[model samples]
Structures are given as structure tokens and as C-alpha cells.
Target chain A: MKLLSTCSLRKVRGRNLLIVPDPCSGNPDRILEVTDSFAWLVGHFKEDVFTVKTLAIALSERYGLDDDTAAKEAANVIQIWQDYHLIEP
Target chain B: MAGLSPDRALTLLFPLLRLSLWGTPLPDAVKQETRLLNESDWEVLISVAKNQSVTGLLFQAVDSLPEDIEIPDKTLVQLAVMADRIEASYRRISTASEIVLTELRNEGLNPVVMKGLSCASWYPRPELRQSGDIDIYLPKLPTKSGRHFQTSPDGSLHFQQDGVDIDIHSRYFDIHHHTEYLPSVPSPEAEWMMISLHILKHATTSGVGLRQICDAALLWKILPDNSKASLPIIFKATHTMRWHLLLFSFLEDYFHIQNPLRHISSKPLLSIIAHGGNFGHHSTSRSRLLKAPSFIRKADTAFRFLLRIPFSLRFAPREILPTIKELTTGNLQHAFTADSHSILH
Candidate 1:
């Protein structure tokens, strides 16, 4: 799934951060801070929804992780994004 | 301009605020504005914008650049990204306010939202304003609710659930608390007085930023024409007439706000506001003041810190007294406990 239009990846102090605006943050706040890996995924999947396999491949290529581990991490990251409505399937 | 040292950082941040708050439409000046900012400068500017609670608005100001404004390509990319983050933040604030206000009302708390959310309506696009924690009247509600409230070291009561934060205030000033604070009173005088005092209190002690000063300006701007005549009387009663006048002048002088609420700007007060951009955080660092190569400069820094004690004592004795007591006697708990009566302003 693609990142929601309401959310954007920002570079703050040289760190990649995902800034999710209100309601989308699942609570009241103008913005919510998220991790760099999550930011990487959002950046990678900016337009189209990517399959779990595609995400795992990207993760494996980026971090040199084994296929199974990358797939698991990709699932976990995507699940978190879905939970926050940062992405939609 | 006593405290102002041609700070490169504030120069960028303050004008950006002017654009955001006043809708003044600066199409030309912005071209040369962000030209010299290095990474360190951007860091400080971003940090100050967040501290002043205006990051989202700053993004809006920069993002509205015309094709002719000529912002650096990298800066434009950064701003486009920041605009996305800020938009998300605006949504989060709106959602959070709705959830918290609904919860509070359902509990018969009679919650009255304060500051950020309340002042936002006066802006051109309400969501463009960056919101901090949702501030509401004291958490002690009407129906004997069980929501626990915590007091942080900075003397604000906060209610946190999941990842959302709401700061509960018992009084408009440092010394007062009322369970029936705002829910019972719908007076415009009370609202204006509170805004005035907030700006005054922050300016005298910690040094306010453009965001705070703009709140005061917007409050004045939104007041009905009939109500405008009463500002002097209200200010006089709160004993903040002079301070309010000085702030209004600064709003007019630097930020380009027109039709000010008052006309009182002396050199001394202007110097204070100019020097203390964003809580007395000028362009230079404080340690540099102490490390001055000249004896006079070193003494000035020491004297300046000492001089600030009385104002600090007057406005925020709750924080300052405890800090001084701790510094001298090495005691901790006594200076910082949460109590309304402990600090008498």
C-alpha cells in the first residue's frame, strides 16, 4: 500500500522521519514522529501498494538480510503502518 | 536592539512567522531571506520553530512560494516534505481535540479547550497553525472523573493516553486555580485578559517568541469593533497594560501587524523583545556570553543572569525559587512541588 497523502517523509537533523498529521496519527497532534526504517518504506512505496515480497526484497537488498528475516521485518513494518493508517492496502 | 545581535537565525524564523500569521504576502523579501542558512542555521531555525510551536505554519509560509520567489532547490524539497509532515500534524491535532473534547464532555467535565485550538480559528487556514499539546481547563472535572493528571517539571499538568498529550491548566496565571475556570465564564474580557497575561508572563520571565506574540495579536485582531475600546480598561485591571502595549508595538514594528490594540513602545521594552527572540534565545549561545574575551563582557553576562532573577521571581517563582534554593542548599523536592499557593506573584 502507498503512504497516505496526509503523511510525508521529512529530513530533520539529518535523520529520516515520517511526519503523520492529525487524525491519521490516531490521536490529536499535528504531527507524529516515526522511525527511519518506516520512513524508508514510505519513501520506497510512495505511489503504489507493494507486495510483501517486494518489500522484503527491498529490505534484504538494503540491509543484506536473509530472505526469511527480511520478509518477517517487512510484514511487521507494514502492519505498524497499517495500524497507524500511514498506508492503506 | 540591546539584546539583538543581527542574529541570522531569528531573521529567517521571525519573518516566516510574519508571513504565516498576518497573511502579509511577502513575495519579494523571501528571495534573499534563506540564502545564507547553513545546516546549523537550519537546525536552530527548525528547533526554534518547533519550540515556538509554529513549525507547521512555517512550512505553509515557505510552501506558498511563487515560482518567482527563487528558493534554493534543496530548500524547496525540504519544505515540500515538511508541508506533508505539518499537514499530518494538523490532522492529528484536530482528531485529538475532537477525541479529548468528546471524552471530557461525555464525562460531564464541561471541558473548555484553551490556547492552541481556541486561537486557531482566528487564522486564515486554521490547520496551518502548528499545535502543541491540547490545553484545556484543569483536569478536575465536574462529574468526579477518575482520569489521573501528572505535573511535569515545567509546571504544566498533563493528561497522557496512548500517544496523545493534553495539558490541563487550573488557572490563566501561575498562582490561580479554579475547577470552574472557563466552562463557567464566557466573557470576552476574560479571554482577552488571559491572552494578554500569557504573553506578558512569558515575555517578562522566559522571553516569548513570535508565536506567542502572534497569539496576542490575533486575539486583538479577532475582537469585534465594539469590544476593541475596552482593551485599555481590561489591561489596566490585569496590571499588564504596559506590557501589552509594548508587545502590540513589537507586533506592529517587526511582524507588520496593523491596527494594533495599543500604542506603547518604549526603547527599553523593544530592546527586550528584540534580544529575547524565542525565550531569550538570541542568535548566539549563552555560554559565549560567559566566555567573552573582555572583562566587561563577562561581567555583563553574569550581571544579566543575576538581573533576570527579580523578573523570574515575580512571574515564575515556582520554577526560579526552587532552582535557586536547589542551587544554594542542594535541596530538590521543595523548590518544584506542584502547588497553586506556593508562588505568589
Candidate 2:
């Protein structure tokens, strides 16, 4: 899956905000304050098409975490992002 | 804040606006002024900022204030809320712009983004520049998706995609004349003329606020020397030299930007803005007149528009006759009918 082309990540006043366009008719964009880990994952999605398994492996290698721990964290984050319409298949 | 004299309030308000300018370092003088302002003064500034449609920029300035500045907690919350809403609007407008532009491009049209989004890139925080709608300039009406758009009385197209407002203009200016010099393809010169004309158009009619002034100032600051050099000729050709010179002085007066061209003192514009607020919506005189009995209100509004004619003439002498003609005819459409290649003697 990849990050939605319409969405953008911005650093405003030291906050990492993921700007998600609302799928509904209302106008205001949904700005979610995202953690550094979530932002990092979003960055990867923006640059490369990746599945949860691939992303978790990359996360595990980068942070030197166990495979199971990285996999669970990545899966949870991806699931939440998907539900928010921030990521697309 | 609401009841403060507009002139007295502007004394404090101008410094805050200068402080809010993107990429300009917070001046020591501004810091001291901000530091010294009591709660009441800050409240007045907030009220003025809201009226002027510049609360987002004000929030940025306040946010950048040094820790010891002692902003009231209530003021802080208010600005924060305003900033958040500004950000949300910015994102929504940006997305709508992209979608519309893509759609236009897909249909083989070269659409130029105008005003709001065009000016945003020059800001430190693009989103902090509040945008109400996305404006796109098309050479002609779109043929395919044309049905999706609604035609405005002034001949622009309006569309709402995903709940975001978008306005498409067939021509850059609503006013007639001076457009022949503008290139078909966008250039710095074209953008400058477009911005200058937009400011003049609004300033002549409803009175422009600080936001439009800031847009012109910011664009002028970064405009290349070659582009800047072309302005005198463009101004002369467009018969807008007086308006352009006055704008330069106005920027220097308020924004503290030096005029690359010769300076002329700003006259009447500031007072008009102070009294009228953004697009004259917050005009004290207007509000009072509005509250009068229905018949009286109509008379006062007409009288008010008439009173502004002299001020508009002083700034844009070329526009006076056309404007008067339109007013006399009582047909607003006549004001927009293009005068084909007519040059003022």
C-alpha cells in the first residue's frame, strides 16, 4: 500500500501533523498529530510501495528490534492509518 | 478590543503585522512592543486581526513571541484555535486546487493557479495564509467538465468538489482594459500585473485589507530584478502607474518594504482599511448604516459608495469614468465589459 497522494505530512510548530483530506462533503481537513515512528513509516510509504511485512522488516532492521515486536507495531499502525484513509492499496 | 478606536488600534496593530511577515526576523523593536503590550492592547490587536482576516498571521507572530512576553492565556487559546482552523482550511483548499488543476490538465488545458495558492509559496508557513477558495485562470471555459461548474454573474465559473470552493476565471481581471499586455503564458511580469490589478480592483470598490497588501508586498520582495524592471513599462502600458506608485508607498509605510521605484506617500488607503476592515465588511459606518431603518440603510449604502468615488478616482483616475458610467446605468455587467484595446489619452 502507498500513502494517499492527496494527504501530506507537515511539521508545524514542532508538531508532526498528517493532513488527511476528508472523504465526506465537509471542508476542513483532518490534521492528526502523529508520533515520530508513525511519521517515519508514512515517509517510507510515500517513497516506496510496501506491504506491512516489508515495512516491519525494515523497521526491525533500523531499530534493532525483534521481528515479532516490529511486526505487531507496524501492523497496528498500518491498520489505524488504513481506517483513517491515510493509506491506500 | 471591539470598541477601540481604529486609528489607535492600528498603532499597535501595524507592529504585529510586520512581526507576522514570513521569513522576516522578529525585530527588536517589535519584540519590545509585543513585550510591553498589556492584555487590553493585545485584545484590540486580536479584534483588528480578525476583522482584517489575518488572525493566522497574528497567531504565528504571537507563537513566535519570546517566552517572557506574557500573552494572556485566553488570548493564546483564541489564537491557537484560529490557527488550527486556518491550517484545516489551507489543506482543504490545496487539495481542491490539485484536483481541479489535474482535471483541467487531463482535459488538455493549461490552468494557472491564481492569487491565494500562488501567493502561499512565498510564506514561511504556506498554510498560515488563510484561503477561502481556490482560484484558477483558464484561457477559455472548459469544454468537457464545464457542466459541473456554475457561472457567476461576473463571468467566472464556480465549482464545489469535495465540499471545497473553487473559482475559475476566464480572464485574470474582472475589470476591462490593460489585459492585452499580459502574456498568454504565465510569467513573473504577468503575475505581478495580475496581483497589482486585483489589488487595485478591490481597493477601488470595497477597500482591501492588510492581507491583500501583504500578498503584494511579499510578491514584490522576491520578484527578480528583471521582472521588477518590467513593472514601470507594464504600469505605464496598463495606465496603472499612479496606483502602482501609491501601492509601493503603501507597502513601505506599513510593511516597511523599500520601494525599488521612486516613493510616493500613501494617502487615504490606510484610513479606508482602518475604517472599512476586510472588504469593508467591518466598517463602523457601514454597520451603523446597516442598523438604520430599511429605507435609510439603502440610502446610506448608496451614499457610502458615492462618497468612496473621489478616493477611488485619486488612486485610479482611468477607472473613474467607467465606474461612474456603470453606477449611473445601474447595470453592474457594464463595468466588466472589456474595452477592446482602448488606451486612455
Candidate 3:
């Protein structure tokens, strides 16, 4: 799935910080600083919906990582975003 | 966005709000008078405005721009998606102010609504004005709220409940000494005068921002005929007419909002306005000066502090106490908190 429109990544203090739109206030609900690893994952697969298979393919081409490892990392990041309501189906 | 950081681009917003709210087409002044910015500036601008508590006004300003202006699609989407939320927050806070005031009145805690809530209605779009806190003056604390409060050095008690900061004041704006200023029945004249005094008081010492100047300007512009008749006398009585007139000049020059007190010159007070909002948060030159090494800026600040003695003595003698206290106390934010970083952290 893709990041929701509300999910805007801001670069603050040289760090990629996630700005999740607060549904109630229509402003930034939470500003969650991203891990360098997750930030890298986001850079490759942004805006458009992407599945584990898609993420694995991009990672294999770019980083030469095995499909299984890439898919595993992708799943972990996706789960974290889902918990935060930052991504869309 | 090209040469400037987002912090610099945020300066573009207040000017944008002024132009957009005019209901006029994007004027030629956009390129020359205000910062010439494009879509690349939007993300940082949005971030900065939010930090400054001006997201509502920023959105309304950009939304009102003419369709022909070439704002990037992504920037537009980012700004537009939050429109409903901004309105919701504004309404929520506005409602909260009404609720708190009504509840306080019921408890016989009759307090005058200070700068934020009272001056909001005077704006072209009241909800767009950033509502920071609901400040009210109560001679005594109300036990009904039951929430614990942190008292600032100025002797004001702040209670945070339901996302609104409710500040209860004892004696300020020198209102206790002049009960006749705001009668039991508050009027626009009284409220605006209080706001002007508040702005002038801060403007003289620490310096104020465009948002505050906007409050005083609009309040003056919108006063009813009867209120206008009585306001000058009140301003004079409060020793704020000179500073108010100076503020009038600043507004007239920057926002094109004319004050009837036009004949009054603000030459003496111009340097204070030069300090810019919240003492030059939006000032390009000040920002550049700040980017200097810490030692240089500290020395510069020290020099400015020394200069303020003579300056305040001439322009605003009321600053003597606060300045002396701040110097002695080392610019502490909380009266009770000893940890210097507590407020920041």
C-alpha cells in the first residue's frame, strides 16, 4: 500500500521525520522521527502502492539483497506504519 | 527554496495572508514587496507556520491565491488536504474559549478575555488567527476547575485542559488600578484598548510580532463610532497613546492599514518595530546575525541589552522593572523551575 496523503516526511535536524496528519485537527497529529533504515525503504517505494514483492524487487536491484531479506524488512516497516495509521491499503 | 532554507521561506507566510485576505487578485507586490517563492517553499513554509501556531492563516492565504499562480500540484495537495482539519481545530479552540469563559462567569470568576480570544473577532477571518491560550483575569482562583496550574513569573496561572491553555490573571494590563477602563460590561473599545496596551507593553521591551500588530491594527480599524470617541482618552490615561501611535505607523507602513491616529509620528518607536515579530523571528537580517557564532551573537545581545536602558527610558520607561529583573534573573522562563532547560525539553 501507499503512504496516505497525510503522511509527509520532513527533514528536521538532518533527520527524516514522519509528519502524520492528525485526522481530528487537520494538522500534524504526530511527528515521528524515522530510522535511517526505514527512511531508505521509504525513498525507494513512495507515493504509489507497493507490496512486499514489489519492495523486494526494488531492493534486490538497488542493494543486491536477497529477496527473502528484503521482503522481511519491508514487512516489518509496513507493520510499524500500519500501527501508526500512516499508510493506506 | 533555491537559495533559502525553509526557515527563511516561512517569512513569506504573513505577507501571503495579508494579500490573500484582501480578496484581491495576486498583486504585483508579491514579487517585489514580499519574498518571491515557488512551490518548493511550501513544505518548509507549512512546517514553520505550524511551529509558529499560524497554520490556519497560512492555509487560508494560499487557498485564496488566484488560480493562475503556478503553485506545484503536490504543494497544493499537501496544503489542501489539511484545510478541513485547520477549520476543525479553529472551531474547537474557539468553542473552548466560549465554554471556559461561560463556566468561569458562572463561578463568579468574572475575567476579561486577554489578547488571543478577544482580538480574534476583529480579524478578517477570526478563526485564522492563531489561538495560543485563553487568557482571563480573575481576582482569585476558581476551585471548580480542580486542575493544577503552573504560575509564570508575571503572576499568571496557566491550566491546560482539553487542549486549551487557560491562563488566570490577578493584576495585569494595570487593570486593577483602572477599573473604569473595562467596565463590568466589556465593550470593543475597552477590549481593543487593552489589546493595544498589551501589544505596546511587549513591543517596547522584548518586541512583538506582526500577529500582535495585526491585532491592534484591526481592533482600531473596526471600533464602533462611540467606542472610537472614548478610546483616545483611555489610551492617554494608560500612557500608551505614543506607543499605540507608533504601532499605528508600523501597521500603516507594512499592511497598508491606516490608523486614525495618523498625525502622531512613530519616529522614536521605529527602531523597536525594526526588531520585528517576537523580536525579529521573521527578520532576514536578524536571522543572518543569529547564524553567526554563539559568542558574537551573545556579545551583540549584551550590547543590545545595554542600549535598551537608554532606549526604554526614552520610548517606554515601563520596561525598567522587567528588564532589570530579567538581567538579574538571567532570562529565566519559569519563576519556580530552576532547570534552565526544563521549558525547552
TM-score for all models, in order of appearance: 0.61, 0.71, 0.61
Q: Give per-residue lDDT, candidate 1, residue B140.
A: 58
lDDT of 3 by residue, B143-219 (tens): 66545665544556665557666677775453322445453336677577667667655544455555676676677
Clashing residue pairs, backbone N/CA/C < 3 A, model 2:
none
Cα distance off (Å), candidate 3, residue B306: 6.7
Tens digits of per-residue lDDT for model 1 on B267-333?
A: 4444545565554333233334323444454344345546567654543444455444433342133
Which candidate wins on lDDT?
Answer: 2
Residue lDDT tens for model 2, B216-312:
8889889999988877887788777888788898888878887866888786777777776665443343224324554453354456557678777
What lDDT score goes with residue B255 in model 3? 59
Model 2 stretches with alpha carbons more than 4 Å out: A1-89, B1-5, B22-30, B280-305, B324-345
Over the true interface residues, superposed, what is the Cα RMSD of model 3? 9.6
Off by over 4 Å in 1: A1-89, B1-6, B27-51, B138-143, B151-157, B173-184, B259-262, B266-345
Error of 2 at B10 (Å): 2.5
lDDT of 2 at B18: 76
Please estimate how well model 2 matches the true structure, expressed as its whole-model Cα lDDT.
0.72
Off by over 4 Å in 3: A1-89, B1-15, B24-26, B29-36, B41-55, B81-86, B143-145, B172-185, B263-276, B279-311, B322-345
Candidate 3 residue B25 Cα shift, in angstroms, is: 4.4
Candidate 3, residue B51: lDDT: 48
